[model samples]
Target: MTRALYSLCGADERHFFSPHCWKAVMALAHKGLDFEEVPTTYSRIVDIGGGFSKTVPVLDDNGRLISDSFDIALYLEDTYPDRPSLFGGEGGKALSRLVEGYSQMMIHPAIMRIALLDIHSILDEGDKAYFRASRESRLGKPLEDFAAGREAEREAFAAKLEPMRHMLRFQPFIGGESPLFADYIVFGALQWLRIAAGLAMLAPDDPVMAWFERCLDLHESRGRTVTAA
Candidate 1:
């Protein structure tokens, strides 16, 4: 029973850095499932899933292909009912969705601004060109221009995390007592920031940072396998 997760990477195949892909990776670990990671570059996405999707984190679960991070989480939960639950129940699923929405809508954009140029720099030559062209077209600006003033953007990015900060003040995780998929959602965001930009998004004294440290320590310290930047 070989499970392969097609993960997005930079110049070095070991550097798996996509936020959505991180979600899948953590979800798999949360379920106590073992998987082989197939490193896929930005230019290689079309070659995966028979061109069905244009993203990484495509899970080849014993010939059953699943794409999209959220969908993959649901699949794992249903398929491995005996394992640890990613979402505790129906209400948990809904709450996870809300957390996912907030991370994608609010956190990702900010991290992108700060990490865009760094991400470009770490890519292989082919991926660098492809990333630049595609991102420039979508953003309607050069990558450098889009990533300008990144240092100044950090304060605003920190301000956006107040909700997570407030929540962490009360509980160790967004999922309450222990980490749930909701915790992984925000973990993916910060993990992306850490890997791509090598910058600290939260203060060392912050509760959110403490929560992230705990998350990194989960499942045999899986997230720590990939070093920052």
Candidate 2:
């Protein structure tokens, strides 16, 4: 049987709001695939059923372990070639690459900062301590020192928004008329800003925001299903 395992907490609002996971889920739904979700704690992720890295969105397809969200998305596209194309055609593929690259380069860092803002609330005290200690060990600087750079980070993020806004204004979706991998990539980054920072990528009048609303509508219509073992 073809089986997939997703490691995620059942009650995490942030994980539910995660665009990365959402995109993967959407792809699975789009392909009409049957999969299982494995509810996991943060620490147990690295060693759930043997020695493995603790990543929440890990996909184990009949014992072949695949980690990382982007990799998982690509795997799905390759595994189920008969499904609707996520990359669209050559122009769409090119657009997807540009959108993914821009999102990773310009948007992800800011989203990371927004997530870290309330990290203490989400993680246990022990986990928080361990996270800080690990960072300190690697960087030789305190977490507080690293966190103090938030203002500059936000400003840098804001500066990049203009160019993104310009690019998105012309197209209904990042990859053109229809949704594609590029749309999902950018949506994942934007989802972080919306949920983590309570921010919007564009003004209310912007066409990009309208596209986002349309994406959300499509997401809601697809439905989410969770099964028990």
Candidate 3:
């Protein structure tokens, strides 16, 4: 059986914009695994994993379904120890978690709200309704109102990356000499922003942009090949 990854994308199907999906994609590429892409959306997540999962980045490795991007990365590392390592080692595994948490907690929310209106525009009608209701509930306002303040939020988002900026100034990637699951965890956010909003979330001179470009070239520029919404 062929491996298959259920990814979240926009209505265009070509717009694979979800950060979590990118994480899985990068991880699979890192492991040199060929898989079928199952493009999906949030409104349809519950139908994946035989109703056990309600999220994107669900991997059907052969026939076993795995939910959660991080878990999938871990599964890859454990299942394919001989392939290119996603996490360098045990210490790297721990650090990769930190990077993933930072991206999910600190970076993702700000960009999500900023890209809210754009995301809605690219979603299918049903997903659009589900997205608006859930997002507005969390944001406590209409998408337009939230988006009106995005310039400031984007600035704040850039400011929050200062620590990572300092770190990347010395290291080429999060795993020091090379890209790892840690780098992908963070890059997924950049990928998400670029595809969903196509905004310059980082300043022109930021070091993260350089690393992101390198990531795009990985696996035959797989990230770049995915059409943007």
Candidate 4:
């Protein structure tokens, strides 16, 4: 019953850049769970878990398969109650739901714009082709086209994080003294940008940036395992 995480990766398997996957990775580490990461490329996603999902961060714990990052976190929380809690309790779980929504709606689009071309650049040929076709179809534009003017998008992205910055000024993390799944939700998006584009979206002096540094230091610096870009 070896546990394994089917993580999304680029041409370099070490470059696991999926924001959702990073959530699962951090959740696993937060629970003190050890598992093998099965680097999965875009072309291979359909072959995983009997094609149970079309996305990565598919956790295979023993024989139980779970897809979706939030679902994985919930599964980890439930199955490993004795381990460090990812959500802490029902209150934290509800808070994490809000955090997940904020990360997806406010943060994910900004990151996608900034890292679109960079993400394409890191993929293998087949994956690159697949990525380009799928993204272009959805975006109705080429990656380069969509990623253009990203420098301007950065300011807007930073502005959107003001709520988090305000909160961080009062506490070390969104989880008050320590990080919970709430903090990891935002960390995943920033980690995605860092890994795919080597871009730092935050100002060095900002409290949000400071919080990110602390997150990178978690689980014995697990987030730093894959260096930026």
Check candidate 4 and list the clashing pairs.
none
The better candidate by TM-score, 3 or 4, is 4
Candidate 2 is scored at a TM of: 0.76
Compose the digit string of candidate 2's lDDT tens values, residues 11-73: 352234445665666666556777865555455566754755556577778888777677776
Candidate 4 least-lDDT 10 residues:
197-206
Question: After superposing candidate 3, which stretches have Cα over 4 Å from the reference?
Answer: none
Model 1, 52-159: lDDT tens digits are 678888999998999999999999999999999999998999878889999999999999899999888989999989989999999999999998878788868888
Candidate 2 stretches greater than 4 Å from native? 5-19, 54-56, 90-95, 136-140, 200-202, 221-229
Identify the runs in model 4 with alpha carbons over 4 angstroms from their true place. none
TM of each candidate vs. truth: 0.97, 0.76, 0.94, 0.97
Can you list the residue pairs that collide in candidate 3?
none
Candidates 1 and 4, the one with greater lDDT: 1
lDDT score at residue 14, model 3, on the 0-100 scale: 78
Can you rank all candidates by lDDT, best first?
A: 1, 4, 3, 2
Q: Give the TM-score comparing model 4 with the true structure, all chains together.
A: 0.97
How good is model 3 by TM-score?
0.94
For every candidate, C-alpha RMSD to the true structure in Å? 1.1, 4.7, 1.5, 1.1
> Which model, 2 or 4, shows the larger lDDT?
4
